[model samples]
Target: MKSLPETLPDETNALQKMVLDYQSTVDQLQEKLKWYEEQFCLFQHQRFGASSEKCPDQMELFNEAESILDSLKQDDSDLEETISYQRKKPGRKPLSKHIPREVVRYELPEAERVCECGHALHEAGEDKSEQLEIIPAQIKVIEHVQVKYGCREIGIG
Candidate 1:
């Protein structure tokens, strides 16, 4: 776009204001045109550019599954099939037995051991879990024992 004609130094105030407004409108239009040009370029690229999902051999797109199967068959002939191999189960490794254990029993008191149905609770079973305790210059096992009690009469404890 050609540059706007410069306003004369002695031009009237109204004329100068009109020129300034026209210049601003021209600048805004130019900016909009540049933005439209950029959009056109991007659109052209997207419509015509090489697509990542497109197959290198365009003819194979129709028979992609068959091509894959053929390739797999060819690959299988060159590969060896394993019969058996031992796989270790994933779990937390057991703590060392050498560590001295401090047994902490979580058993119910003698008074509380009685069932709510007036029947005395009997020792059913217990669950034992161990945690490693780290003290300065010393490592020991803290064994937690949760004793279970059951009321045979009410079948609840």
Candidate 2:
């Protein structure tokens, strides 16, 4: 039998280089996979988890136009005195006039109308209030009929 060479052959060197290249490629792919996994975790938290970051102030965005209008309306005379106005108390707004209304009246009985002193009580000023009500939508169908007349003298009707 022939004895093996003390140094590696050219083919063995090429195979070793290919093995090193494959290992490096695998390592790069593993690093990429780890990065993608971390990104996915962050995305899931943003989509489902309660956010800890403070929201951007939206009132300033909405008030920007109002402030611009007020600036445009400013005058030299008005700037001398800082005009101040009282702010009204906030409460429920009045109902729209377009909505239909139903009125109901309540009257006292004839016997109860009389006062304890024997004089009859007369009607006075009344208090009024409004309430909102919701009614579900309704569906219905309508039928149409047509009538036809024929003339005896005419060939077509």
lDDT of 1 by residue, 1-157 (tens): 4444573445589777877888899999999999999999999989998767567788676699898999999989988889698899997888888889999999888999888888899999999898988999999999999999999998764
TM-score of 1: 0.44
Q: Which stretches of candidate 2 lie over 4 Å from their true place?
A: 1-91, 138-157
TM-score of each: 0.44, 0.30
Tell me the deviation in Å of residue 129 in model 2.
1.2
lDDT score of residue 13 within candidate 2: 82
Q: How accurate locally, in lDDT, is each candidate?
A: 0.86, 0.62
lDDT of 2 by residue, 1-157 (tens): 2324544356978768867877899999999999999999999999997675455675576699888777777744355665598789998787666666665546666677555555665655354556656566632222222222223333223
